[model samples]
Target: MNVADKNLARVGSDELAANSPDTRTRHGKLVSPVITLAHGGGGKAMRDLIDDVFIEAFSNPTLNTLEDQARFQLSDLARYGDRLAMTTDSYVIDPIFFPGGDIGKLAICGTVNDLAVGGATPLYLTCAMIIEEGMQVSTLRQIVKSMADTAKAAGVFIVTGDTKVVGRSSCDKIFINTAGIGVIHQDFKLGADKAQDGDHILVNGYLGDHGAAILNARGDMHLTSPIESDCAPLHELIQTLLTAAPNTRFIRDATRGGIASVLNEIAAASKCAIEIHETKTPIRQEVKGFCEILGLDPLYLANEGKLVAVVPANESQAALSAMRDHPLGKYSADIGSVLPGGRAGRVHMQTSFGGKRIVDMLVGEQLPRIC
Candidate 1:
């Protein structure tokens, strides 16, 4: 089967497992219904908790060994790629559960995307959680199940993890930190500073759904919409793009600071200017309406599943085609291009109303703890 077909098959299996009543029932019986301080005391209570909740859910030959550190065979890793890419990220978004995903899903996809954008095939992840005392065990189980399902769909393993509990008010209900390892083929080279003049700028799909969905889910705005977080794993999508446009300059997931921040960083690093058309940028109608109501610019909003790629102008169509063929990038668009020298370290956007304006890095946080 083709790459997309294989990816879809895995996703389908993951969804079945995620939605199965048997899976939920099994997880429910693994631990106490509510977590207490003893679970983190590093004693018998901790051992039982680990075995029942984490180990039971994330079972694999490597993790089953339960070593302090996971060991992989060098020969096994060498077959995949020569270089290893490592990334770490923390997820603490409010309302733990959001429209499209939860903290668990965010932790997995965020780390995987970090590796994928660097031309790496993500391989393994380390999950570390800090749970507030008195948190519901069912909540933890659900999050762990989500993580396991995501890892399975992405073809990665959760090889190691740690759990800690703090005072009831010491932290949010829970916080998750994930570190990922990936393998980059020796033939590929990618970097932010590699952007050059005449390169085309592309985004995988609609932007800012995660930010808008989270804000709405919080209910503080007293507004509601069908917007959902665009959380997803993009390793397969990246692989497809790389196969189509081997000379692509750089790829970055539009995460915390959105595409605007990523573009500004690229411009500064490559000492080049970028020009994008506002009309070309894709934003969901719901997200656009939500942002408009709040007087917020969607360009500055965060995206969980979206990515910005800089590719040679000659390969722009090929790259766009590859993205459009992928499930995660159906709304992909060619947003802009890198300008020739003379306007170094600047980003300009052509307004929908036929005006041009500079797009700069955000002065301050527009949304806090947005993951």
Candidate 2:
């Protein structure tokens, strides 16, 4: 039988067996054999699987609710007067190791930046790893060590973790998923919708360095450039900026979908037009050449150590100065501003020659499976 047919047949057989009166415990509850994909699919099968596995393991009221998200009350003393922020990310960057940093570093930095952009001071993280069979233990050690270093640099702790192993062919060499929790200052309120017309958009640094650096590291294309990934922790840079501009509205790290996608999202969320000046947006010459030769748009490319900030015009310069003084934001610039004209929720690029064009989200996938 075909794989699909075989799976269906087994599922049918299991369902019949599960419903049979004989398939019950002494307590008279139906029993299941093991976990399956249906367990995560949120159907009758999922309910049974959860009752059999997860609830049986943890058996907590918070987890039993099975709502879209778990909510709980935190003590005001624990809050320390800061709002809570949480973020999660998975890293499966190829080669594991690459220019500037490795997948481990990316995993930690990626989630930390998410919390940072949410106006949270990242404090803790949980790491989960999936390793393929026959993978070298030494390599795993290296990745773990890198995670430790990255967390230390960002001033966060890895409070918990999990590890799983799969058949050699079932997974790549390794994959890392990290979830982070942070506390946002009481005065700092940032969200995509907080963006307003006349708000200036500032980027922490040049673009596309991470994506280009990974491509070069892969040896997929025959080109050489000193453009290493700008992968670094932004907690300090962000903290410095927050100190100067307590009234900042929103911030986001440009990662998977890059600056274009982020600006498009902010524009749509805030119902404003984002006008980015190509001339002012920094791009290393090598990156521009690489993108030109490879038919890539730097706008849609990923960045690791960069953030997009929308701040008041009065505080824009101070924020820029704070960003520039920080090592991670040394190349920072004021790239654009929120405009009321043009299509709402759209991003327009002012070309280097002084013309305008639309910048949109990545349609499918330009650089696939990058972090």
Candidate 3:
């Protein structure tokens, strides 16, 4: 086994402790094994949850950084003059299978999309499976195969993996965690903190389809339509944009918090004011109607296949054209631009009728399990 595989094995063994259980001599106090609501509530309770679940599942030197992200050293691409790009994410969408894809497919595509939007050529991935005790083995096999197929289609490999079975109630059904590595050309320096005055904001396709599709699967809603999740792998689109405009300021895929959250994060990171046009954002008619009826803002709903690109005015058209040619970005549009001066990192939206309003992150998530 290679370093990644060996490190993964050490982490697994650490968590599993002994092959057979010795309850009489078990170490530690009677901390409840039944997961508590406080586990998800952000606090020490949450920290304990991370320790018992995430850390125990995938502990390693790289992840020991404990930062919101991981940093590592790599010189594998010296020949191509590229800088290494790395990112990790976990998928726990309730309904594993939905309109556009299942959890297996989403896990691979989502991680790849993150690196792709960051201007990286996605290469390798690590997948970890959290399976519920009563989950059918046949179903598990199907999901794993689906994941393998998606990775193959994306030209990436599942280089390493870890699996664990929890009590049925301990998790929804199944959750997947993915870590990815990619190579970014040395000349490319895209980041959320790089937006500048007059920078254009563009999105590749209509938003909220993924969230809506998942909601529909819940069976609690009283509506139905042909709307499906726009889950797609975006590495190809990223490559096209990179080939056409290697100098993009920033690139991002709107996932859990949606486009609005992504834009807010970018603004805060770059310390710039953003002004977006309400009329310019592209939304499918059915998605618009569904949001209105459900009292949800499409802006805050999740999306898996859409991307936000910030580019210089000179290269905006070229970027848009390149994105539009891709099957996943046929509906690309310029939704907004950077403002010169205002509340640093604040976002403003211009209503079609000519009024400006502040757009803030959703107080609480509008939709849950929308990876």
Select the stronger candidate by lDDT from 1 and 3: 1
Model 1, span 121-193: residue lDDT tens: 7878999999999999889889999999998888887878889999989999999999998777776799999
**How far off is residue 123 in model 3, in Å?**
1.1
Q: Give the 10-residue window scoring lowest on summed lDDT in candidate 3.
A: 21-30
* Candidate 3 Cα misplacement greater than 4 A, ranges: 1-77
**Model 2 misplacement above 4 A:** 1-79
Model 3 whole-model lDDT (C-alpha atoms):
0.75
Report the lDDT tens digits of candidate 2 across residue range 289-343.
9999999999888999988889888899999998898888899999999886757
Which candidate number has the best TM-score?
1
Point to the candidate with the largest lDDT: 1
What overall lDDT goes with each candidate model?
0.86, 0.74, 0.75
Candidate 1 vs 2: which has more lDDT? 1
Clashes (N, CA, C under 3 Å) per candidate: 0, 0, 0
Residue 169 lDDT, candidate 3, scale 0-100: 89
